[model samples]
Target chain A: MLSIPARRTNDVTPSEITPREVFERRRDFLGTAAGFALGTALAPLSAALASEKPLASIKSPLSTPEKPTPLKDVTSYNNFYEFGTDKADPALHAHTLKTRPWTVSIEGLVKQPKTFAIDDIFRLGALEERIYRLRCVEGWSMVIPWLGLPLATLLKSVEPLGSAKYVEFISAADPKTMPGVNRSVIDWPYLEGLRLDEAMHPLTLLALGLYGEVLPKQNGAPLRLVVPWKYGFKSGKSIVKIRLVEKQPQTAWMKANPREYGFYSNVNPEVDHPRWSQASERRIGEFLKRKTLPFNGYADQVAPLYAGMDLKINF
Target chain B: MAWWFALSQGKRHVGLFKIALFAVCLIPLLRLVWGAWNDTLGANPIEFITRSLGSWALNFLLITLCVTPLRKLTGWNWLLQLRRMLGLYVFFYASLHLSTYLWLDKFFDWQEIVKDIFKRPFITIGMSAFAMLLPLALTSTKGMVRRLGGLHWQRLHRLIYVIAICAVVHYWWLVKLDVSLPAIYSVLLCILLGFRLLWPGQGRRNVISGNFKPAQE
Candidate 1:
């Protein structure tokens, strides 16, 4: 018989090998290949397996055809200023956030304003997987598989008044846990807003998790707002309060620079930011900058919201 | 140790010191290469590489500016020998930075590139700063120095001060907030320029430029 090398005592089991579905995810297999340390923490490997409290969600009919951005990029790279402005800051620092004792309140121009526990929010509607195109104001984009109930479903439960023209989303700001809150980068709590109709749009999502697990803290744990038609920042993370109001609310970015950020911060290839061109955005994990689509390729579905208005002025 | 500091007879040390500084300067590029080879360039590899190269380019520019002040203070005339090479490294890193944006980021989307150059103020200023560096880099050769008169060459190289200032402003405007890093670079650039005004010697060597003792610009 030919000499056969035995399986090494330190070798990984077949089950432990990373799934081949995503190319970047194969780094785990290389960690055992000898020479280089890939710098990925072992803790995240189990996290990616999504064995811990995996919530059930059905695939949504509205999902795009694009392959989801790698989970590592979706988790490791974030724009949550509550943690910090740097892309990696949130992933490094968001462990300090306490998502267990969270409660979100719905009030203002609603007949039945109520504060609900985190669990109660989940009971509001059936969860679904919405693969969305997230275009950031800084000329970057990502396709994320979000697990959440629709914002309209949640808004309907609260019962809004006819006079409620806008819905403001207020993110939780804990200075003791969140380090970025200590900096004067912007006003304390991140405030995001949408028109009442936009809030009730079927495309809008009140996301609670992503990649099939309760959301990673960096990607906005507990709960977050997802408006697929707008810039990524318009989707407020770690929302604590939702208030319905008659007048347009001033969001965090608008307060910081009203000239650059407006109330309706929708994605538009024609409208460029003052500092850089938004005509093209480099997608996460991709080398080439792709041309940005009007309303992030959801113009067919959501463009009706801004029917006659000039997008440049609203941008 | 005593043999190392023989300032009057430092010709033997010049070659070795240049080699040492050149290797030291290449460390940033080496790290970037290692990172790219290992697939450890993080979530957005292109952006990370682009920013890393840009930051190093700025750092090299600042380091090139430091050569004259250090030479004047320490009487390390040998330091001047490394100035041209240090300046050329800035162009090297800058060229890499622009290449990353062009090849990897834009993928030769010349339409978007041209529009960005015209529309974006930061890109406009950054492109201008890089443009100013071309003549200085092209004229760095000993042959070119002799071709242009010493006075004319010195005057042309004064554009470095303006280039450095434009670079720092480009950095300052590119950031959405946290002007702290750019603020530090600005202070350093001011001090570098202010030294010329204060001592009034380490500038374009003209008899009328300063009353102080002779020092090359």
Candidate 2:
């Protein structure tokens, strides 16, 4: 019963970011690169493909250095819904989700709980980009470079009550905007939560961006929680509210089918999903023979948290 | 028609014709395997190929099972001649699909595989379907048909109906979104099954039963 969900951080997301802003950023970036290399020795290829530059190389939406590490297969295949809803079409579909003028409504057991706009929250702490592997409960995993500040530092502002047992997250659920949310596959206003102790964990991040750029829409732009220890879905996407709860909250997936998805959704291969096997997962870009690590190779840091409890029962 | 005539005329190269027909049947399988080798089988190629072959197996099995009912409805018995071959081809592709999952996806991980059989809903249904198909394929030969007798053989073959349902369930569970294809397949299966239910024993059996009253035999 290692509850990794609560250990996730709350991020200060951008209030002014938009899809148009991202597109313009790409245009300006390519424009600047194209300008600098106009008269150099290898200028012929650049000149020939100047007009069709964006089409030439599939540019990663996040920023990379001049000689950045070529991305591995895993993190590149993301499923952050704040960015977009497509399993395969994340970066492209995320363009439709508006991330600006965003406000996170904080309520429940917090001492000074209030609805703060994105700017006010982001101004409280510095954002950092850290790469982490995001493994889904559905048995597919990805590695992503995320930019966000830690949850503990941000929690200082909200001032959690001493009785606060769990912190619950609620994602936006406007069916007109989120077409996928309209479907009844899982309950709308996707909910996930973490224990207070887990939420206070230093590794938990509230992500703002990826690849050194403003967070892409498909990668949960604006704001989303990042719990590196738990399965990816436990880190809820497209968040709109943070309620500090005295009791454990009923989450979206658990509400849909309590028998399959437990609230403490630690990535344990031993406990098979009711509909599929968790014994093995396909690491997004890797070969089939690659053995899925226990707790996704983070057992060293987080395994001690669940020492006395029976995982089988909690699962 | 020409090929049928040639066979009726007792042509010397009738075996060659049968071989060519067999090769023609093999073409779709050939193309699919080629696509797989060329790395063009879409995202998650193994799953795609495995599922494709599995669905085709179910389709061909349903088609084979429909032959007798179809012949009864149309007053034509020639369709029965194609049933055995079609049934065996269905088994062949079903085996291929199962083997692909076992070898490629699971890497023959027996413990995990066993866990999947009981734990996963889709895999549970799929494995049951495959298990039923195994007996059907094993008893397909002429010797087994004679040993089992016609009545027992027909009884044993009715297991295919259960297999068909299980196969459909297996397909429906695997889909992440847009269940339109699975819904269509189920409806098609219903119609196929519905034809048999609506028009059972309507051809030569009716004529014989009419003449003999209680003693049609």
Candidate 3:
């Protein structure tokens, strides 16, 4: 039987939470012995808290029936250019990232502009597991079980001013820590943004962990955003700053190639990228390319957000 | 260098060299098959296959380009004998690369596939390059060479230079950054094409005295 832990509202006691390294070691052990009955029995329960179901009261009707992508593929195949441009570079190079003593600054047009420690953010609301379909702009998709609170919970606490129209997320860019920052792969300190309402969507996640354990550094440790309806790059990783702005802020990819990547990178199959068709995507674990869905199959929920707007122009 | 001399000795040895080159060319495809058999194509097997075949196609193009310059430099006039086979392998790998996209990636959705060819810049360039290669491949046979006559066939085959440029551009535009690999290919192509420009008639003697005589008849 799968055990869905009741959502915890209060601060998690340190003793109850296992260290990331210990959890990873246990996972490696389990993976090696996964062919055995014992490993098979404990596999789903151990890896993720939410096994094919959303947490109680999370209201995730957009979730897919697809099994979550294996932890190996999820961790290994990533496009976090802060580590390197190659998909595997993050997995190899992100270990040097120090995620513990992290803080996020909420500035710009917010009424209560302040920096919050990682712990303080964790204590804002109950952490719940949400299984979401993460679609990349490169025409690949993955089902991920993310552990985090909704972005709305954090935004409400920040108290954005009436003038605030866009919310920008800035990722960490310490060159000493992230070697890829030294290279001119992208403009340093990666930036992503969403409209104020989009940021406040129930599906928008401020993720801190994945697979029941603390997030692997490659998978964006300490803090990240998971905007399920948008392209994966819109979900900035290792986020250090959240700035509420009056106008649409420039995002990293859009700045790099505006024709290819737009500010509103909603997963619309009809709007093809300049380099490739977006009508279909290969799910990471699956062999066949599945037809891509508008808004990554979250259209029923997110389509209203872009109602009457041309997605092709927005994209 | 020693192996080139040994392999270039006589007609029988030249035949042996062609067989050896054929086996050597099959290694990459064989390795891919082995990788598939071992379930080692990584998380996205289709992507792995697609990228591998595309890269092999480009690599073979580079190798095909190298043959003319190598024949000119080495004076191993028999080296010209392998050019047809090397050129054919470029078409082979390129055909596989296109088939991977058409069959495996798109599943023969001709409407979407045709839309992709027309819509995407990279696909447009790649499809054009493949289209150019088709005539060159069709006319590669000895019988067709006789039908077209020598000068016309050579002129027609010169379309390869354009195809090579298109192939490099296809790769360059497709990559999202870190263009070191494509840059290397571009520089190598420049050197090969540049050599041809710098020394126009230098290779004519070698071609006349070499195996190209029989094909001219």
Looking at model 3 chain A, report the run of 10 residues with the lowest lDDT sum. A1-10
Best by TM-score: 1
Model 3: DockQ score: 0.40
Give one digit per residue, the lDDT tens place, for model 2 in A52-169: 2311121223322212221322233556443334455564455677777789988888889888776555554444445576667767665666666677767768899999999999
Model 1 off-target regions past 4 Å?
A1-52, B1-12, B204-217
Flag clash pairs in model 3. none
Say which candidate scores most in lDDT.
Answer: 1
| Model 3: residue B33 alpha-carbon error in angstroms | 1.5
What docking grade applies to model 1? acceptable
lDDT of 3 by residue, B1-217 (tens): 8865575574457777788899999888887777766656666766777888889988998888887787777666677788888889999889988988888788898998888888788999999999999999999988988888776677788899999999999999999767878899999999988988887775455456543443321
Q: Return the top candidate by DockQ.
A: 3
For model 3, the local distance difference test gives: 0.80
Q: Rank by lDDT, descending?
A: 1, 3, 2
Better of 1 and 3 by lDDT: 1
Candidate 2: tens digits of C-alpha lDDT, residues B1-217: 9855665543355356546656766766776777666645433455556667777787787777677676666544444555677778888888888887788788898987897888778899999998998898999887887787666676688788788888888889986544767888899788777776677454336444443121111
